[model samples]
Target: MIIKKTSLVTETKDNMRGGNGAPVITHVIGGEILGNKGRLYSKIVMQPGDSIGYHQHVGEQEIYYFLSGEGMVKDNEETIKIYPGDVMITPDHGYHSIENTGTEELVFMALILNADA
Candidate 1:
């Protein structure tokens, strides 16, 4: 089965996960699609000045693949520059956050899955 782009659901949230500005979330799959399981597959768009707050993952892990634009990714206490084609992984028991520091929008694909599943 193929999921068309137009068929995908997109939602904009202000201060997502206690973040800074509103970010657009394009849900590709997961959640109810996974029977309320621990999984997330989505595209995230963060405009200038937008950000996702720092948070820790205990029972899960997340991977972020930058598709376009630039940003600063805060991994624990370190802030690293990120660009297109870059991939970052925050393992279980780790913390991470992202900020759009460029003039253009920061676009990325995020995949989250249960650590033990």
Candidate 2:
């Protein structure tokens, strides 16, 4: 099945996952569609200074693929700069967070999958 861009669900979140500022989240697919395979599949847009706070994944793993702009990611205790084409993975029980540090909007795709799947 194909999903239309106009039909995609979008929302702005404040202090998402404990981060700062509001970030736009466009769902590429809903949880129901993902079933037990995962919990999230979306495109995230963060303006300069916006962030997604540090958090840990218990039974799941998350992946982030940067599309544009620049950002910084705190992967466990290591802080790394992110740019277009960059990809980050947080394994189960791992901690990670991200912040938009560029002048333009930071765009990326995020996917979270159940560890058991």
Candidate 3:
């Protein structure tokens, strides 16, 4: 099966997770597409000053894979810089957030998977 670009869905959410600015999310493969095993499989774009505020995963794990641009991630209350080819993961019971600190836009891929009990 093939999913074309035109068929994909995109949305822009303001103050996402108590963030400073809005970030665009382009859904590549939605949860329903994967039978709910995953919560998110999408491309995330954040303009300068944009961010995804700190949040916790109660029963899941989240991964962020940077494609281009630069940003900072809040991992376990620590701030870490991120760049292209960088991968960060927040396991179950973990907390994290991300902000685009570069002058240009920051693009990355995000994946959220359910944690086994």
Candidate 4:
């Protein structure tokens, strides 16, 4: 299916689980609310000193791609710096979290699956 800009959609606030978020979430596309199958995903835009909470999955693989700005990722084992166009993957047994480490906004995409994850 194709997404059309002229079509009206819904808007919602994202009550972030941690320190100072952008204060909202827009469902550009995904499941449950958008009828996607099995995958629960979203686009999150964060800024310096803002972040998402630390969490993990039991049986899923997750990835965070740095679209812009700079950040760091801790995977329960080590912490590493993230730069533009960088990617970090978290396996099922590892714990991971990302933080903005730049002077500008950090943009990225988060993907999580509901099944066995």
- Top-scoring candidate (lDDT): 2
The whole-model lDDT of each prediction reads 0.91, 0.96, 0.92, 0.65
Q: Count backbone clashes in candidate 2.
A: 0
Q: CA RMSD for every model?
A: 1.6, 0.8, 1.2, 3.4
Clashing residue pairs found in predicted model 4? none
Output candidate 4 Cα RMSD: 3.4
lDDT of 1 at 70: 98
> Which parts of model 2 have CA positions greater than 4 angstroms off?
none
How high is each candidate's TM-score? Answer: 0.92, 0.96, 0.95, 0.73
The sequence of per-residue lDDT tens digits that candidate 1 reaches over residues 1-117 is 788999998999899778899999999988666554457899999999999999999888889999999999999889999999999999889999999999999999998877775
Task: Summarize candidate 3's per-residue lDDT along 21-61 as a digit string, tens digits.
Answer: 98999999867876658778999999999999999998889
lDDT of 4 by residue, 1-117 (tens): 776755524343343555455423434556654343335455567768776667766666666767788887777868899898888877776677777778998877666644353
Candidate 1, residue 6: Cα displacement in angstroms equals 2.3
TM-score rank order: 2, 3, 1, 4
Model 4 lDDT at residue 42: 55
- Tell how far residue 101 is off in model 1, in angstroms: 0.2
Best by TM-score: 2
Which candidate would rank higher by lDDT, 1 or 4?
1
